[model samples]
Target chain A: MATETTQVNVLTAEDVLKNWQGHRRVTRRTIEAFPEDKLFQFSVGGMRPFSEMAWEFIRMAVPIVDGVTTGKWEEYKGSKPETKSELLRLWDVQTAALDEKFWKIPPHRFSEVDKAFGQWEMPGQATIQYAIDNEIHHRGQGYVYLRALGIAPPHFWERD
Target chain B: MATETTQVNVLTAEDVLKNWQGHRRVTRRTIEAFPEDKLFQFSVGGMRPFSEMAWEFIRMAVPIVDGVTTGKWEEYKGSKPETKSELLRLWDVQTAALDEKFWKIPPHRFSEVDKAFGQWEMPGQATIQYAIDNEIHHRGQGYVYLRALGIAPPHFWERD
Candidate 1:
């Protein structure tokens, strides 16, 4: 005879939001560290400039959040901002939108699956995490670009 | 009056694991792109070498996984590997350890809070995502380092 058991989790819904925001804050700082000229012009190891990567973030994130909030998948092609400030402004819009709408999704919603933007049939949480993950990865490239130009990047661990 | 409604998500536990592994594969490839001499010596903007960042990943990941499986928190301070091969070998060790133990954790365990390494009192899942996020962020740095050195890094999106 064999006995079976199930383990329950202790993580609360609030933790996810806090964790995501911490990383988000640090990522924004990374963006601010980039000089205006370098944001669009810099590339290291044949990688795209930070601007292109930022555009990718905008392209994927806004729609994902909108889809999650409204359950309507809308595909988007970003209006690539030519200036770094415009890029930041766009980023701010998305950030505010998430803050307003992310909670509209109940905690359990994170664990559910969805085909975001007509692609990536993954859990709701996975798509959101992917958005954060994408930004962090690209910021790493931005840090490198700044360093190559002899500019110091914001410390990696900071959330502000 | 506005009616409150709960949103349903489409993601699942299996998707989380798959997504985590996909990012892990690409990050490992990023490590392989580093040249030996530059692995420890290269830095842009006063950042630690990519090897050191890789060491941070190894230090954090092995313990977090071990803690999840064994229910014991152990802190580690990595003795920096002098060579890239040694670093990769240690990384493989941790990867194997993760494969063996990660599934031992039932899905609910992800939502449980654990003070990883006796610090970072976060949900087990958040800690794991942090590990993945950390690697992706630093790998971006590795890509930049490679490009600055005139080396072509592995494609950013490839997991294979």
Candidate 2:
């Protein structure tokens, strides 16, 4: 008797993208929950304001995709948005860009190692995972900030 | 002309375990950085003390592993530790248990969808990802609490 072995892909490229976007949706809700004044000025225990952290997410996200796909690493030259509305506008634009550019990645490239932005060296997919992880980490800080401000954050589990 | 294609496994079960353990290492250092008095009693913006949040991580992590592997869900029945030392002791023990039990999972099981704790329904691997994401989330809150107490947290990226 002979036996055959087969391999299964645990996560597909589309699945990874959807997971990242689900997290983005929850984070967008976190931004919406913030009071306008506190979005840029609030800090607890000396952490930066939530707006600054959100800017960090924006800086790394789509640009990372561009780097992974095109091997073109462009430093973010955009000015920071001073108000909540402007911030949301940029966020929406980048969200669309992420959806569009992410598909351009060849599926085989996900497992290929690359030095993202000539800095962190990891699998292309891991770099993308880092972006998602970083957002969740900061959003947790935003939740703390929201509670301190006496506002409830968007539910952590309700990523959709 | 003929063409052949192959599937690539982007992340293995061992890789997932290592990633989770790396995050746990960073979270452990965070627990070590807290002032002993503030671990259980400190709060910012009305969040729970860092120790309470740590307990939430402990309650969910290894038990989720057991539930996934054995299809037997056990509610955490242990009493909360009163001091940081006791807390770390339990953390270390559970950390060891996680390594041992994670291997018991059949590889195909990673993609099998089940309702974790009879509540959240997703692939077994995703349930594990949620555990890691939740820890990162709470640790961000811990970082805020530490800063408010005039303490510095461990570097966020140095998981090792």
Best by TM-score: 2
Which docking band does candidate 1 fall into?
Answer: acceptable
Regions of candidate 2 where Cα sits further than 4 Å from its true position: A1-9, B1-9
Candidate 2 whole-model C-alpha lDDT, 0 to 1: 0.84
Which lDDT values do the candidates have, in the order given?
0.71, 0.84
Candidate 2 per-residue C-alpha lDDT over A45-123 given as tens digits, one digit per residue, 9 for 90 to 100? 7789999999999999999888877777787778999999999999999999988888777666777888888888888
Candidate 2: how large is its RMSD?
A: 3.8
lDDT of 1 at A31: 74
Q: Find the candidate with the highest lDDT and give its number.
A: 2
- Estimate, for each residue in A1-160, the C-alpha lDDT of model 1 and write its tens digit: 0011122332333444556667767767767888888888877666788888878877877677777666688877667799978988888887787666666765555666788877778667767777777788888777778877888778766664
> After superposition on all CA atoms, what RMSD does each candidate show versus the true structure?
4.3, 3.8
lDDT of 2 by residue, B1-160 (tens): 0011113346666657777898899899999998889898888877789899889999999888887777777888889999989999999998998877787776666778888988989888788888999999999889888888898888877867
CA lDDT of B110 in candidate 1?
68
Please give the RMSD of candidate 1 to the true structure. Answer: 4.3
